[model samples]
Target: MRLWHQDLLTFLPRAQILGQHRECCALRGLGWGKKHSTIDYVFTYSVKRLVDYHQLVLREMENRGYKPDQQWYCPEYRGKNTVPWTCTLRDELDDIPDGHIYPEHDDAYREECLANLRKKGIELFP
Candidate 1:
C-alpha cells in the first residue's frame, strides 16, 4: 500500500521539506513516540517515511486496501544505514507503561529478514 501510494509521500509535506536527515529522523521519532498531535492534518509523517524502504511502505499500503508498490531497495545506499538508531515507538494503547517486556521474536525476525536479503543478494545496511 505504501510502496505504490503516492499520497503517503505527499501527505506529509514536512518530510519533503525536511532539509537534513536529522530533521526527518527527528520527525519520525516524534511520530513514533505518539507525540502525534500534529497528525490530524493527514495520514502521518512517520508513515511517509516508509518511502525510504520497500517493506514497510508496501505493508502499510496493503493494510489500507491498496496495492503494494513495487519498490526496490537502492543498491548504493543499501549497506550504509548510518542512521545508527531506531525510533522509540512507545505504544499509546494506554499511558500505563508495561515494564520491560522482553521481545522473544527479535532473533527469529532478524534471522528471517537477513536470510531473505542474502538470498536476494541484498546486503542489509546495518
Candidate 2:
C-alpha cells in the first residue's frame, strides 16, 4: 500500500527506482516513518510478501513519475535496517522450536519464503 525508493548505487547506478510494495514490518510509530514501514511490512506479511513488497514499492514509484534503472531500482530512497519477526521477542510461537529461528536456525525463514512464493505462484527470477 506504500511506495519506497531504493539506493540505486547499491543495485544499479543509472536509473531512479521506486517500489510500490516493500517488506512488511511492525510499526513503532517513531519519527522515522520509513523505518517503521519497512519493519511493519515484514511482520505483517510473509517473507515473499515482504520481498514482493519491495517490487510493489518500485511499481508505485514508477506510477508516481519515477523511472527505474535497468534493474528497476530507485536512487534516492534507501531501506534502512530494522528488526525482523524471527529476531523479535515474539520468536517462533507457531513453528517447531528450532524452526522458529531465523534463516540460520533451521532455514525456516527461507523455507517459508520459498513456500510463500510458490503459493503465490510467483516466478522470482527471469
Query: What TM-score do all the candidates reach, one by one?
Result: 0.21, 0.25
Q: What is the per-residue lDDT of model 2 for residues 1-126, given as tens digits with 9 covering 90 to 100?
A: 322222221232112232122222222111224444323433543333333335554565566666644332322123344332333322323332332212232344444434544565643342
| Candidate that would win on TM-score | 2
Worst 10 residues of 2 by lDDT: 22-31
lDDT score for candidate 1 against the true structure: 0.32
Residue 6 CA error for candidate 1 (Å)?
Answer: 22
Query: Model 1, 2-21: lDDT tens per residue?
Result: 11122232232232222222
Candidate 2: stretches off by over 4 Å = 1-45, 70-126
Candidate 1's C-alpha runs over 4 A off are: 1-105
Error of 1 at 8 (Å): 21
Total clashing pairs in model 1: 4
